[model samples]
Target chain A: MRIERNGAIAALHGHCRVEDAETLAALLWEGSVTTLDLSGCDSLHGAVVQAILAFQPSVVGSPGDEFLKQHLVPALARRATAD
Target chain B: MIDELLAQFLIEGREQALEAGADLAALQRGPADPARLDRCFRAVHTLKGSADLLGLTPMGRVLHAAEDVLGRLRGGQGEGGDFSVLLEVADQVERWLDDLDTVGVLPESASAASQALIARLAGDGAAPQVAAADDWDGASAFPGRAGVAIRYRPRADGYFAGDDPIAIIKAVPDLAQLRVSLAEPVADPALYDPFRCTLVIEALSTAALPAVETALRLVRDQVALATLRAAEAFAPAGVEVETARRTLRIDAARVDQLADLSDQLVVAKGGLIELAAQAERGGDGQALGQALRAKQAELDRLVAALHTTVGQARMTPLAPLLGRFPRLVREIAATLGKPAALEIEGGEVEVDKAVVDGLFEPLLHLLRNALDHGVERPEARTAAGKPAQALVRLSARTVGDQAVIEVVDDGAGVDPARVRDRAVARGLIDATSAEAMSDAALVDLIFLPGFSTAETVSSVSGRGVGMDAVRAAVTRLGGRVEIDSRPGLGTTVRLALPIRMVLAKLLVVESAGERFGLPLDGVAEIARVPADRIFPIRAGRAFVLRDEVVPLVDLAQALGAEAGPSSDRVVVAGVGGEPVGFAVDAVVERIDAVVRPMAGLLAGARGVSGSTLTADGSVMLVLDLAELLA
Candidate 1:
């Protein structure tokens, strides 16, 4: 798991498996106005996806994986807008 | 406040999680049931969603894995697999949930445990992969089986919506085939948008559309499922989802609140009756007094009806408690190396949830005792001309307002001679009385405290308790536990418990102008006999009622009140198979009253279970019949 901050947004990087879910949640919770970047990731576990869905952060980038981008990215973006 | 909400979540989530496991066990016992399976699936999904929304990462991971297992189960995989793993996972989630609620974080082992369970759910040898079958031409993966075809175009960024299309697709109860087509034209590898899913998916599934739609409920609009013409024409096993819901869950606090209010209403209504009586005596406004009497009657009827309604709401079917016995007996039998089979009867009997919950420990103790000492070794049983496998029967049925639960084991029965010898040796009973006791009385001595027949205290029943403890618990709940044994046949323990707590039928009796209420459930009969019928016995006084000898006691003396006139009325109460009579000054009318439980110092007082307000404003103490007789 990797966490990077750029001003108000905290961008998540690397493959976030079940083990990384808690840490990812902690970083997002601790930071304000955070956004998720899935462009550099390989796969996101259900927990990570849950974290994204719950946090509802703006997506500055998208993952290369078709399933992640088309399904997960839109799901996350809709929530971010709705919230 | 967050901690409290999390605590409530933990409690509800844990219950739902266990129910999910029970649902799977039901599925394993029957043919394919898409509806029941879906119900189980929904439970896990709700738990997972709640955990994620609450930012409970550890809980989310655990439930997500359980959800996956349910999905595969919906796919008709691991149909006959033991659901112990699911229960264990749910139990672990509860433990971690408790940790999270208390310490605001999960323990170190949470993630590892979740990962392990996830792997187990996914480790079912090979997950059946349905090959894409298009056009339904001459070749088909699932030749003759009828299936619905689904065209799924998930939201462009469904992953962000917390939608896992792949997981949903895998969850379809019965998947026959899958064909994926890219919705857009192919782009160069360098310019490919890997983050976006642009697939137009189509699938032929043996599962019903309702099952598929429910599985993809979050993305219901994305999936278009239809029955294949050929398969539908040949096979008519079209599964129609049944939304027949049986039970509605109500918070226990709410039910208790209603019952408590009804009880208070009953007490308050008594004050109104007293006012009406005063009005009648005053002889002013006779018409108003008549109207007050009519209104009081109506209020009494409504109050009684409301009390009954609240009591029914507090009642829950005994299925859940009985459902756990199969697994319990199996595990206990295995551990004890005893070949015992558990046979349950009348599990559909419903009773107060509090009563059922209170029964768990005592029933568990009896079951363990049956397995440990009651059930004999297979070889020993065969030699004794009995079946090799011992049978343990647990049954519950409502006998009037009481639930009579019995546990019977077909094993080596208790030896009365041994019990008599043990009682004498333990100084519980003198040798002379032990020698003079009948076989049944000797066996009854086993219920005495500090009694154990085990040569070496076994771990199962060696918890420094005995049948006496079981009896004590049952007595505390205003129930009776009776033990019966035949020297070589078997032992049967019957627990008869009241079904509710609201209204108790009491037979009011007076002692020195003070009234006492005796619960009518335990009263066998009220007898009036002349002085000639009474005979002097060694204990006190004895009377023969239809050839049965009953010992009698004076209610005034027993209650430590002032002595009253010689009473002719005898309120005979049941004490196991025997009847004991309490002579009171007068036998008043039988009426229903809301018995208030004794609290504070009175809680520990013997022979008084509760008290009820009389119509005359004074309190009438309800005697604990069993305790008084004991």
Candidate 2:
């Protein structure tokens, strides 16, 4: 329920936990989801952060959670920019 | 020969480490000073040379990697490199020196520690056990850096046992970094078990060792906690040796001035000796006495100059103490996931070494509190029409003879109402008194012992001691701390400390037939009020002084001594912007004395700042009226 895929963009909402990591990873692994919109994300579990780190997807929209917005989002953005 | 060389190496190594660390911190603060960068590079290079000379291979390896990184930094390359890792390398080297000084050799773990540090400095993105999951065994995942490194490999049946590995790792206090990977690669896709939990969770927590251990207690067998040899982890509560080094480097000019004063004193002594011989010969006694008086005056002048020169030699710039905070601030901010930047000013301002040394713990606590409780999260900050990145300024400046240090944060200023509620809930004050207290007084309640507004105890700042400890430490340094909060605007905590601790002007007063010294700077004025002018106010008493009713506290009663008849002498002192009068037996003469901080069993005695010996050789306890009234 936390991950909604529409076309090539997948939007994550609320708190993304370990259970959503599999769906999110599968969506990214299938080579269809190119962008992740995290504007509505309140927080992310460790597994969720790890999946994002591993997949190296293009991230868009800042999360509402301070940790994700300040640390995780910037990290993801840095990698994307580097690529 | 080797012992002497080792001693010299330890001293020089510590100096180079401090120099490099401070310069690196300065460079990280932007507009990178080329001179500082070059100096840092050279310092590291020198340290590397010494390490090699001493055959400290592990230290040499780490320093060589650091030197290379600094080399890149100097060449205007590798701008993306993390300065915190470099700072860690410097800290690790300093810790090794400490070990070498104490144990005569680096610990056996130094090699492994150096490798981890070298990997971090190499910018390889793969520290031994940090990111390289392939090499991780179920056991032996030593900490790659400071703080507690944890490896959690939940059993395959962990899912069935209702164990949530991710949640367990998430619950760790002050979790700085987390990495997840598969425990074992699946040989075949067909053989993969859907319900099996093969997740390996590795995390670095800034929490203390016991806290991490307790968090992983349930999965103790499946978890491994390795505490890295970190400066903070080892010291935990005070400044590290690099910042609080006892050895002082005084300017040659000051030493020359001191030598001149000593030479003048010697000449003055010769004059006195000639006058003494003239008196003994019974030749013109009056002229001999006049000559002796003149000689004594000259000696006094020379001694005063000498005393001042020595105090100047003891003066140390605030940079060494304040420089280390930027890296620590970054670490704490990263750990808390807060977007905060620390701007330091007046690092060049000089203060007595004692003041600088005693200030580190309190300043660190204040910064921690600012990041942990003062700064709002990015979302919250943005919603409040503020910048996502919070700004905390650590500044110092001289005000008159006092050094004023301030920690100002543009974050969610403390809510006095919430503080009042917490104070009442914690039984620090009655509900009626809390409601009657002013907003400023309500905010000041945060400094009351055992008072904390933190909803949950975070490892960052909520480790039993609260703002009260900060207040105590500052007061112990002959300083007074004040906090000003503007609801949602911001908060500023200011500490006004004496520039020098060697000499203090104290107003001697007698209470209960025993004499005490009160810092004259804190004493506003002395007044004598007739009994008719004093009237009972609230539970105590007050007197009208120039149309202002200042509350009165009997000195004897405040110090737990039996009160004699209340005298008319009232000494008014400022406490949190209000005048409070202390009635003592009599107003004695003011004298300039050196007040030594109390030690031994009397160190923690309440209401006493320090002790000073009187001209009669009697020890007088200096009363901290502000603390006593509080």
Candidate 3:
């Protein structure tokens, strides 16, 4: 588990390919995240992505992966587009 | 191929065209606000472009003629000429489109309707009497239509279900834009398996809701679809620009999650509070305890801020619900031959979005009852020394933590005797029961199931359901509805509801060794007294509190729980303006809990409103104050 905090915002930095969803859900439940970051690291467990979708925190810094940045980030937060 | 494009326009073009349809409604009502006229004109311009593109001569001709009429209205033609002709042309165009939907082409008789409507819309002066009630101001009037955002994902086993995301997107009609992204994480090429489909497809379209829903009907369960107000669509329509604020639509579940997180903070704070009490007695870590207390205070501020920000997201103005009323009442008045005009105020009052959504149906029932049953006819009103046009005032305001919405009308009020006679005539109650019931109780009989006062069963409000459904719906939302009327004066229905139902603070009390949550707002006091202090009253025990005599009942007996040994602790709950005390075994600590109504069989149980959990994971029932007291 890789976690970084800037005030109330939280970002999962570096590689995180394997994670139990409940652990992340518990952590997210403990501390609310207004803006979540998904950059530098690319691999995400399927359940983690489900959690992120359910949480609906704004995604930032998507490591130049155009498909991820365009589709997943925009899907996560409708307002987090380049516009 | 040209036919296919027309089919696409039939769906997508018509959806886009509805954006300007309200301007036509506004045009018929009175002088067209310049901006509103422009909106209507612009809509036709876009539709004409698409129709011409599809080589549909009939659609193009109608739209072009309508555009000319809108252009004249924009150039100060002064709202005097017939605008209903344009509305008819638009409706005919829609009918032609609907024909295309079913038969794959326009109807054969479309040419005649097109010719007649085009000539009238172009001011050939064959104007008929305008219906006059067709007034809608576009988005400015009731623009609560939010854009539906959808995300689609095909599961690994989606192949078994015959679901393919690409084929689904390709099949979608009126797709404005589309994007496909990988649902897979970054991995080595060796482990990449394309056969296991994992892609999230995101799309935005101006297509109507039902069309998109039909397109994705096969795999709707595999995706997320949410209605959102697109931020960019607010193109500064230029009315009330100073107070405009851009909005982002978040799902209600997300806001509820934030509230849950905030609730977790409260639960954690409860533990910290207990620790602080321990440290204060120990004295060894007094300095550390003070520092922790200060940090807890800081945490309290941050959590509170989190709470308020999330709360604001769930709130919406009451105007949209209120705005739709004038148009509705107008139609009903014309139908019933009553000259009733509706006046709405305090449209700016902000309430929880859920509250606003749930409010419309109940208010509709009451307003229909008022119009069909309460309001007197024009001649009847004149004879009674009242205005010919009955005035129905629908207003809203915030009173403390509750929202008070009243539907007040000046007309013939409800007669309790008549209601009683109707109840007996309808066999809803026996004559003996009617004799024994008070006037107020007889009036309340209108809310009983299958009870309606409309003697002749009017065409408008004569749906078989009664006000009982209204009361049941409101009670489900933890709200109270009240009715009051004088013999000849008028009837007023007042509804009081909490701002939101998710989170509430309750004074924890124990009855018969079981914990119950008493809403803190309803609890005026918690008193500890000797058992000898209790005195017998006519039907129940009486306790003196603050120099006022209060009726007391055993909380355990009221809830039908096992009666344990009665203790000295009593929780005083407010009933209207009077005080009533509920005797319990003990008053525990206060808690902020998520008060949710019970589910399944427990839901039908009386006196128990809902259930919430303590931090220790024990389930506790929250008592219904009104039900228990009654």
How well does chain B match by TM-score in each candidate?
Answer: 0.41, 0.48, 0.41
Steric collisions counted per model? 22, 0, 0
- For residue B74, model 2's alpha carbon misses the true position, in angstroms, by 47
lDDT tens digits by residue: candidate 2, B52-84: 657799998998888778767766786534455
Q: For each candidate, what is the lDDT? A: 0.67, 0.76, 0.66
Residue B386 in candidate 2 has what lDDT?
95
- C-alpha displacement of B335 in model 3, angstroms? 1.4
Candidate maximizing lDDT? 2
Best model per TM-score: 2
DockQ scores for all predicted structures? 0.07, 0.06, 0.02
Query: Sort by DockQ, best first: what order?
Result: 1, 2, 3
lDDT of 3 at B605: 76
Q: Give the clashing residue pairs of candidate 3, or none.
A: none
Model 1 complex DockQ against the native = 0.07
Q: Which 10 consecutive residues of model 2 chain B have the lowest summed lDDT?
A: B232-241
Q: How accurate is candidate 2 locally (lDDT)?
A: 0.76
Model 1 residue runs over 4 Å out of place are A1-83, B1-97, B100-301, B502-630
The deviation in Å at residue A32 for candidate 1 is 65
Residue-level lDDT of model 3, residues B1-630, one tens digit each, is 455456546655565455554445445554546645654665576576566555567887888778766766666774454554565556556666777778876676667556745654544334321111112122222133334444666666654455545556555665544544556553543343334555566665466545676787777545444333333334323221121122345557668767776877777778777777867688568676686777688688768878777877777778867875675677678878998989899898877765775676577667777888889999999999999999999999999877889999887888999999989988999999899998778888887765778767564564433576567556645567888887789998888877766657788888887888999898888887567877999978897777888888888888777777978888888877678888898876675566878899989877778987654345789988778767
